[model samples]
Target: MILSVALLVPWATGAVLVALDGRRRAVGWLAVAVLAATFALLAVLTAQVLAGGSQEVVTGGWPPGVGIVLHADMLGVVFALLSVLVLLAATTHEVLAGIEERVFPGLVLLLAGGLTGLFLTGDVFNFYVFFELAMTASYVLTAYGGGRRQLRAAMVFTAVNLLGSFIFLLSVAGTYRVTGTLAMLDVGERMAVVDPNAALLIATGFFIAFSVKLGLFPFHFWLPTVYAGSSPAVAAILSGAVANIGAYGLLRFGPTMFPAQLRLVGAAIVVLGAVSLIYGAVLAVARGDVAESLAYSAIGQVGYVLVALGVGGPVGLTAAVVYSVVNALNKTLLFLAAGIRGPLVAGAFAVGALSVAGVPPAAGFVGKLEMFRAGIVVGSVPLIVLLTLGSGLSLVYMFQMYQRAFWRAPAPAGPASPLPLRLLTTAVALLVLAAGVWPEPLLAASGRAAEGLLPGAAG
Candidate 1:
């Protein structure tokens, strides 16, 4: 029941806010209260899980194989915590900016609910359902401000996601036809015995869908435009919260549900990730706008996670998990700070830029170091070389953006709107910095989460 409440509280609160209409300023505070309550609830649940206990709840008291099942495992808890914290920070920033319309907060809550559903779902078909829930909300949120560019970006974003969803549904149908069950764990066990031809088609479909969502190489066309056009707040959510779904899908389904297929497909994924790292870094160096540069940087950083996963070992997977969490926080801070100007904002950007570049003692460095260790563990010399070169390119582009944004003098005497500052916003930035400098706890959490997913590891 508590797990279910964690999933529903956000959507339920959003519904109340929507019913209250858009004019009331009190709705904003209500939204904050709802998320704060959610944070407290999640903390309790996380503590319970860490104490060697787990919870599972089936909707409508139906059987596990037949009904929607939500479970609180280590992996889900980590992501749920990340989602809640990021949304809290985003909501606070929006409120302080005086743009706290009812719809904005409502949509943020709705987005959080959808992600919760996605993370908690234990059934394959239910995963697709929650995936749609999250995607649909994200599509609308991306275009919430509704300008020409935003509308255009939203169209591309919607079309691509819808197509991906359709393909995912087709895969689900294929899997069901072969295995006759939608339970994720059961499907994984049965898939090897199913007809190879059908399995191949289904696996290909799932790969395409996940890759599209992750914005891998050729399928990533929608990302830059969408990031550039959306509000910085919305951009932070998309980059931080939404992008994790794709990585999660790959981590959850790829190894467990489609092991044979992953073995066949892993090299391609590794290649795509490497290409994205170099391509995105190069493009960032050429980009002029702050938002666009961060967008490209996100591509590169996510690529690192992909490459780590493609290595396909306990160490590699652990590194990927750590990288995903660290990258999400770092990217969110960078995108949020990109919207800021003035001396204080400049300092924020400098700190965030160094962190993103994998500077020493930051969270990003922990992830980078782990990734390098994983590459060595796998004995992949070429990958080691690529990772080193990728890190160098990342530093070059990140420092270039920093020099342009912070070091360059403001244009002489023409009036420009000053960047807003609020305590909540600064706190969020500092928290990210703190996590980077002292990341042992997050690293331990990520390692435990990865071990829970790995075969023959203690749960």
Candidate 2:
């Protein structure tokens, strides 16, 4: 029941918000309260899971293998918590910035709800449903502001995502036809016995779908334009919450269903990731807009996760999990800070830029270090070197953007009122960074989540 509430709260809240007049300030508060409550519930659920309580709820009284199952295992909880935190921050920031257009808050809540469902679902078909939910809400939000650039970006984003969804559906159908089960755990157990060629074809479908979503090298055409065109809050959600689904899918499906194929194909992924790291960084350095640069920076950051996944050891897997959480927070902060418009905005951007550059004591630094260590243990020396070069490039581009945005004199000073909401949001982002710097709690939580997948390593 609690798990169901966690998945449904956002939609429920969105319904209530929709019924209210959009012109009133109270609607925004209502939306915020709903998200805050949802966050509280997730925190409590995470605590219970950490205490070794099982967090599975079966719907319609169906058996575990056949039922719609929602499980808050470590992986699910880590992402759920992240989605809640980012959504809350974005919502509050929007409310404060007086950008509380009626549909905006509701759409964000819907997006969060979809993500919650995605994380909790234990069935493959259900995963697709939730994926569509999240993607659809995001599409609407992308074009919500009604600018020409946003509209164009949203169209590209929609077409690509819809095609990915179709591929995902075909994969799901193929898997079900081959194994006679839609439950992910059961499918994994049965996959080893399926025809080798059939299995490979089905797995290929999943790979192509997730690759497009994650913006892997050849398929990443939509990322820069979307990030550059969307509002800061929307960009934060896409990079932080939405982008993670790709990595999660790889972790969930690849190891369980295609271990042999993964071993065979892993090197290709590693190579692509390495190329993305260099390609994205070099392009970022060549670009001038702060948001566009960060957009490219995300490409490199996500590539690190890909490299870790390709390594396929316990340490590498752990690094990937931790890196996802750390990178999500860091990216969210960087994107949000880029939206600041006052004299102090430059300082805010600098703090965030330095953090993303893997400055000491920050979350990015910890994640990067762990990943490098994992690469060494896995004998992926080239990956380790590429990651180092990537980090150095990140520092160069980020600081260059910082220097231009802040240290460069602003066109003659003009009268302007400070945005209180933006300031508050920046404060929240700073606090999030602080948590990352001293990330004992999040790391412990992540360790517990990683344990479910690697039971032997769950110390």
Candidate 3:
């Protein structure tokens, strides 16, 4: 009952809100109130899961194989909570800044519902369905400002993601054909006995699809255009909330469903992660635009998650989850700050920049520390060196962008941002600081989430 209500609140509210003119302050606040309610419901659900166990429901009370299953374990719940928090922040930020389009608030609610559904789903086909629901909302949100640059970004994003979705659908079809099951756990168990060649091929398809969504190197060409060209709130939502789909998919599908394939490609994944790290950092340094630099920074930041994932153990998986959470917060703060200018805005941006550079007293430091631990646990000298060099490059690029954006004298500043906007941005930065000041909760949650995937090793 809790699971079903959690899912329904956002969808039902969003459906009604979409018909309203969201540019009206009342309608906007109504949407925010509904999202806040949804978040509270998810919080209740999370507490229940933590105190007891996974909460699951099969619609209509049918058998597991026949009914659609919604499962909430630590991993899925953590991601779901983090994603909605990001959405709440981003949506609130946009509303404070004044929503430009009539559809903005409603689309955000729809996207939130889609993301929550994707995270909680226990079935692969339903995962795809939720994935499309989220992507469709994002595609429209990308063009929220209705500017030429934004329209172009929407086109590129839609085209690339459409291809990725097509590939994902095909992979789902192949999984069903090979295993005769759409349930993720059943697919994982059955994949072991299926033809290795077919499994590997299907695994590769999933990998590519997720990689495209993640904007990983070699598949990252479309990312900068979209991130740089979109409105700040939209960019933040894309990087902070939407990008989780890729990371969550990788963590869920990799070691669990296709362990053999993951082991086979682990080395290659680490190498690609390294490439993305250095490539994005180097390119970020070369870009002059603040948004473009941060876009590239986003590309580099996810590299650490990949590196941890490729390391493939409880510690590594924990690092992946931790980094994913911190990265989302960091990007959300920076993107929102980038769009505003006033008292406390520069300081807020600086905190975000420090976090990105893995400076102590910022949440990113914890994530970086976890990555180093993962590398050391594996006794991989190259991985450690890569991490060290990546950290240094991250600092350099972040400093450059900060100096360029905030430190330089402005020609003539426009009107200062609203008080609520500044306060909201500062609040997010302080959350990052608070997490760094006391990381026990983040670490514990991440460890538990990792244990859910790997089952025994100390995270």
Best candidate according to TM-score = 3
User: How many pairs collide in each candidate, listed in order?
Assistant: 1, 1, 0
Which residue pairs collide, candidate 3?
none
Question: Residue-wise lDDT of candidate 1 within 1-459, one digit each (tens)?
Answer: 678888889988876676664435567667778888887878878888878755778988897777789877777788888877888777766665655344777777887888888887778888888888889878887886678987887898899989999999999999999999887777888998988778878988987898788777767888899888888778888888888888888888877787777778788878988998888888888898877888888778888878987887778888888988888888777777676666666667666677777787667778889989988998999999988887888888888887776678464332123444434445666776788788887887887777766654432
> What tens-digit string does per-residue lDDT give for candidate 3 at 315-409?
99999999999999999999999877766888899899999999999999999999999999999999999989988998988898878777784
lDDT by candidate, in order shown: 0.79, 0.78, 0.90
TM-score of 1: 0.94
Reference-based lDDT, residue 25, model 1: 53
Which stretches of candidate 3 lie above 4 Å from their native place? 409-417, 455-459
Candidate 1 — which pairs collide? 363-436
Which regions of candidate 1 are displaced past 4 Å?
22-24, 100-102, 409-422, 456-459
lDDT of 3: 0.90
Model 2, range 213-269, lDDT digits (tens) per residue? Answer: 878777789999998898877888888889878878887788756776677788887
Error of 3 at 288 (Å): 0.7
TM-score per candidate = 0.94, 0.94, 0.97
Q: Evaluated with lDDT, which candidate comes out highest?
A: 3
